[model samples]
Target chain A: MKPIELTEAQVKSRRSRNIAIALICVGLVVMFYLITIVKLGPSILNRAL
Target chain B: MSVINDHDPVTEIYISSAMPGDFFALLKPRVMSLVVFTALVGMMAAPGEIDPVLGVIAILCIAIGAGASGALNMWYDADIDAVMSRTKSRPIPSGAISKSEALGFGLILSAFSVAILGLAVNWFAAGLLAFTIFFYAVIYSMWLKRATPQNIVIGGAAGAFPPMIGWAVVTGGVSLESVILFAIIFIWTPPHFWALALFKSDDYKLAEIPMLPIVAGEASTKKQILAYSILLAPLGVAPWLLGFASIAYGVIATVFGAAFLWFAWRVYKMDEADRKMLPAKKMFGFSILYLFVLYAALLVESLLPKLLNLIGIA
Candidate 1:
């Protein structure tokens, strides 16, 4: 059987995609987290008194 | 500054290789946003008033501190990120930004954030922000990450400090309210991250990262997810019970907490072949909503009492 060798471009492309996804996940979590922070902080100010 | 700058060949090359996208990626804007928001909540929930200027300064310093951590994490994780399918295209890995540049960016920002927070806000707030940065970049990245699968479990606290620091920024000291906020995030971190791990186990395995799903089989990871969800319900309501919120908010918290546990239960009950793994996906989606709604409700509750007082009803 012949060995299936990957080109450098293929390997690099595959790796870059993973990073994009990771960055994306990080972004999603942060977006909600911030929305909560901004949304809640002022409300807390009014209610906690 | 010119829109036509892209017409120049030099500018074209720069844009392709070193875009603002690349630099913003280093800030880990996603991570920074969370730090900022939680800190904002802390500031609002704290018992005293903060000067608007000081509050803004504190948030900015924390943002920079978080960005600094992201840069440093990129510097260290560049190697692993280069290998994994989820992180390979990052600037360093993609040959866009050099490793030294990322490290220098991280270190400079770290010092800048800590110094600014100390000088502009209180030293205590600055000190806490500084530690949060160190915990994320040094403790979590340099040590716990590769050394243990429990990395996020312990390291998650680094991200949880923003509210505490924010509370300090307003009140000039740590309080129970901020600590409860921290606990909510800390508990949520495991299950939230574990959901990602459940779906992306192959990526972590490829990167040689010891995320729970990679080290333990799916069944064990699922069990742990249920366990965390079970603990998360009551913890979610801690802020309300401690006099940090009101009865209306308390009721909302209970409903939201129950819904989150239900989603976890669905995920737990799924058989391996359940409809292309919809259960995990549902759990993941609801998990995001669970945190957002939880915080949103807190914010709403915070304001409701004031609104009532203003209307001469409270």
Candidate 2:
């Protein structure tokens, strides 16, 4: 019947967890970029024709 | 929400106020870490090269799939989990999340992981991910877990498939080397869990899960643990013998495998009156380290050559 309110500790824990997930997602994006560079090299941007 | 008669199911509560941590807990992060590590080692060990992006994508899918299975397992085992002391504080049992919500979360992640993997990588790896999820969630959790003492023995396959799937991501198919990796984990699992079961027999008894120690008794369980450890010893070194790993890895595997057996032997020789189950507890702790160190060795074996080549040392 009423909106559920999170305790202060619960809110703090939730914030930290969301931040951790966000950081991991960012790390994955950075890794993908580095991997693309290592894999493709200078030839990546070259015209095939 | 409404209350029901004692015989009827609890009225379905639609409270969706679950915290972020609760949802993450549903993913079983500890188990997902092992799946990710093994799958990474598998991909690295494969002979051919894979696009770095594709490799990362595959690993992500594998991790998510593992988490999906974990959530589903929690959903199905919630009742027993509530009864078991070790699992009584889990997200569902602790009321951090509801069963229906967990089921929905697991199914969505399962489908998402498989579909993304298929589209971004090869279909074979995707299929393996799907099967692994299904095996753990359906075959293992829903059926085998409650049906017999051999539940973990067969259900362990669900855990073992990650490395093979990792190999498939790179090689596009299975091979002797990948199968060997699968076998090592497969063989390692029984002794590992049975050691835990030895100490946690009361939990299994209370939950009525029919674990080997409960069904076949402690002495029999200890003997089986030793037998499996003996089998695991040689199998751990198979990658080195098969020429994929270096002599150094072979030596490490041999030493770890031997130590694993020594622990198993200790567990077997432990007295029944030894209610502390010190040997079984020791074996259980060491088993986690054993797998971690062995996989770390394999990962080094896969990476060392490249590192040496980069430095012009080999």
Candidate 3:
């Protein structure tokens, strides 16, 4: 069995795409956090103990 | 990779060379910018208070939804796009991204945008956003584009939805004011696209798409452009007339709307033998400016009072 090999250009492009995906994932997490805070407001902290 | 058995010979291993920029291009950034601007105006003009954060989220979702539709359009229109010179360099047409990839991207974004908008803003706006994506992707790109010369006329509804969606984000329902905003864009689209069609009739002809100029001839297209411009002129000023916008906006809309009509009339009077198509070209340029100026005026009118109040000067 032989292992598949990627060209340098392919590797670079794949890396860049992975980084972009990572950044988007991070951004979405931040966005969801902000949305939760905005929607819940101070009342979120005032919930029953 | 495993060595192929003797029975099955190995062909070629597909390695994607597609960069992130190629995928970004699939979103049609120019169209997304217009969607963002119009939706922002809609949000601002609505008579309700919205948290700035929520408003930003709503705009982001709408823009993403619009981008998704653009990706779907690109995926479906790749073949014709390859034929048309203006669109030949698009990601799909240029082979930077595969059609299936584009379709998957569009579908994923569409779902995310609609769902997030629903959860964050309100269901009504989300529903409108979903319908807009469906209209652009399925109704316009797949059906109307190939089947009829009136594609842009009816399909313009998809573009007109953003402002209404924005308004919905604040009001949670449609109103006369929002409908007027929708009408302005709806009426403005035909003249804008037809002006481009007049200059690029050959491209539409080559792609076998039934644009008005390609199917109904330039004379009829010009008449239709002028007719739409006439309708749009009053409609652009309707917000002012209806008392939503101030007199300043009214005056701005009236002046810009008149200019739009003037450009359309110039296009209408352009001679068939005029090889330069200068009038049509200028109309196309002015049409974009006209819509932008009208929307920008509305946006400024909506935001200025708020800014003034914040500065303790209102």
Candidate 4:
């Protein structure tokens, strides 16, 4: 099968969108981790079976 | 080596050339900022302490939820937006983003914001945020906007929910104080939007939107604006009356509210031949300032003592 060619503008926009999504994902990860720590505090290490 | 079918229709594929800024524009950043400010005041006014990080998360979620609704509203209103001069340059109307993409973006963000708020904060606040999105996207944008002259009156509830949601973020419940905050914005909406509709009536008429000025004549719309301004004046001072804000805020609210009335009265007395609609325009500008100053005063009042004690200044 032949590949579908993308224009430079399209490729550039896609790259920027991907980078934005990646940054947002990283931010969300850090936020979730901080929230977990804030909510649980040192008790996060005291999980019961 | 197969025979070509000449009768088959050609299908077009869409590739997004939208930048991150376009997507951000879809969020309606100006409106989101107002939501953030009001919600922050609500959080500060509520009687409790919250972890700084969690408080930030709550505000972020509420802002995202508000933006999600804006995206959905733009998606649904793209047709009217394209016709209206004021909104013709919006992301969807400008062809920077497609309707389906906006819908997808709104839905995903709505779910994520609600889920994150519920997990990170209290469920009550998340529920309020979810209701706000639903009210704006479905109830206001889809149903009320094109249907009635009273649209902004009922639809204004969506905008007023942010403070209550903010109060819930810290307090885990609602109170008379939060409800008063909600009422101030709710009553303020009619006069604020009617002023814009007075000058922009031609836009609404062209777009076939049933704004007050387009549906009810300008004279009747002016009367309604005046009446709402009268109601809004005292409602703006309720935070002080309820003992939530100090006398300084009371004085500020009274002064701003009276100025709001003066502008509304000017709009009421404006001549039919006055093509400038200057009074209406001034009223719109002053109304925004009124809300911002009132909320900023409340926020400072709530935080000042704590801040002073923190620095040993009190």
lDDT of 1 by residue, B98-209 (tens): 7887898899889978886786667998899889988999899989988887889999899889889988988788877888989998999888888778887878888888
lDDT of 3: 0.93
Position A2, candidate 2: lDDT: 33
Model 3 chain B: lowest-lDDT 10 consecutive positions: B1-10
TM-score of each: 0.78, 0.86, 0.96, 0.96
* Model 2 chain B: ten consecutive residues of lowest lDDT: B8-17
For candidate 4, what is the DockQ?
0.48
Off by over 4 Å in 4: B1-11
Off by over 4 Å in 3: B1-13
- Judged by lDDT relative to the true structure, which candidate is superior, 2 or 4? 4
lDDT of 2 by residue, B67-165 (tens): 999999999999999999999999999988889989998999899889878877789999999999999999999999999999999999999999999
lDDT for every model? 0.79, 0.90, 0.93, 0.94
**3 versus 4: better lDDT goes to:** 4
lDDT of 1 by residue, A1-49 (tens): 2233445654665466567668867964674455446546666557654
Q: What are the per-residue Cα lDDT tens digits for candidate 4 across B32-59?
A: 9999999999999999999999999999
Better of 1 and 3 by DockQ: 3
Report the Cα interface RMSD of each model, rounded to 1 decimal: 15.7, 8.3, 3.4, 7.4
By lDDT, rank the candidates, best first: 4, 3, 2, 1
Which portions of model 1 miss their true places by more than 4 Å?
A1-49, B1-17, B273-275, B303-314
